[model samples]
Target: MSASPAPKSYAPWLLMLPALVMVVVFFGIPMAYMLRMSFNLHVDEKFYVPGFTFEHYAQLFANPLFTAAIWTTIKLAFAAALATVVIGYCFALIAWLKPPRWRFLLVGLALCPLLISEVAIIFGWWMFFPKNGLLSYALVSSGLITSKFSLMYTEFAAFVGLIYITLPYCFFIMLSVFDGIDKRTLEASADLGAGPFQTFVEVLLPLSRAGLAVAFSQAFIWAIGTYATPSALGPDTLWTVGYLIQDQMLNKHNWPMASAFSMILVAGVAVVMAVTRSFMAKRQAVHV
Candidate 1:
């Protein structure tokens, strides 16, 4: 016909060029630099030699503080992810079951914490948790306790802040999954004399397992990498890997060690993501 329009192959590649450039410039270069730097040796207070060595990585495991930080990071992330999943599931289920008109309000309320910046949220909680803040004032004023008591600088406060920050992600993820589920299934289960708990355990939970895995993984990764909220709210002893990374890079001026810690964090997150993907794939296969 008219030379068959000469094919459109180059157009797609041209369209993708910008994205490729951005990725290389933003991600690939930095990642390569970090990996290279991780192999370097720290010479002194302000200098790191460019020679390749595994000393940084070796020190990461050999140092008791670093190992403890790894354990603490895992423990906090796991606990926060678990709590977020359970609470978010309940909240999403309630919102999903409500009338369409009420759903908007429920989602809005759930989004309130997310709408605020993390720093602002932390500050708000900081004020509310201190001895002179509203919580203590109210308890003392209402005769609930003899004197004002502070909840600040406690593991509980850190956990609360972590859960608050991550809950919205878990909620939206489960909410989307819940939207795809048919309410008629619940009705059918009820018709078959299944109670609410039975329907949830048997039908709802199984159906949303993939979303749960994804949400939990995301929350865990976030918690693991977060340093500010935990550091501000938790006691000094509650050191996390993220805090340690910052400490190594900024306070100690140890670039190689910082890079090594960052690489380890990245590896841990990657492993979590890989496991989640595998679990989700298996779940999908079973359903199929």
Candidate 2:
């Protein structure tokens, strides 16, 4: 009998067809249309009309409000990502070092932020930061302050909210990295007369560097794309890229401008991801 024919290689692409179609329909088409409209007309503020001009793009950069918003967004994202990495690293280390029975519980707590809805989290902070909220109540009850004090509508609140929202994701990512590492490496370092700080700096940190980078990037990306928590918890001046997009589309009824803003945000995120992946790749190559 003749040998059986080899199996076809079309299976993977066939499986991916639906996702490919969804991506094209949802992402590609919308982006193309938005790009086209970015060069279109404002049409007396009533509607947009097709035109070929760079005036909109020019005006976007010319506007100081937009420029300041972009700066605020960058700062908030950087701060949040740094904070998340530090806090998540500690939390994940705790989870990793704990007994098996408590490990799951600790991880569950760290991941709770991701599981909760963004709106719910915002509401929780909204209640907690106000003059009549938990902080004020506690301080007043303990006589720490004669009058209620609130951190609401401040940059600090925004930072707290951003960190809280992104911490779980970073924690989970770092936790997985910590899990992959052998604890005996740390023990070995200690056995050789390395102190706790020295072992961490030499062994644990080196091994975990890639993970830390990944977590920071993840948190930063999320923080950059988020608008709700910042707007709700932060002061009126706390404008960000996502908030700008929302403003242009909804409040200003400027879809093309909103689309333009979105494209810029996407470009920013792509650059960050590219840079981070490049760093990770270089590190892996060096290690290998």
Q: Estimate each model's TM-score.
A: 0.92, 0.92
Task: Report the CA-based lDDT of candidate 2 relative to the real structure.
Answer: 0.89
- lDDT (tens digit, per residue) of candidate 2 on 24-133: 99999988888887777776774577777777777668999888888899999999999999999999999999999899899778778878899999899989999999
lDDT of candidate model 1 versus the reference: 0.91
Off by over 4 Å in 2: 1-17
So what's the TM-score on candidate 1? 0.92
Each model's lDDT comes to 0.91, 0.89
Where in model 1 is the C-alpha error above 4 Å?
1-21
Clashing pairs in 1: none
Q: TM-score of the candidate numbered 2? A: 0.92
lDDT of 1 at 59: 86
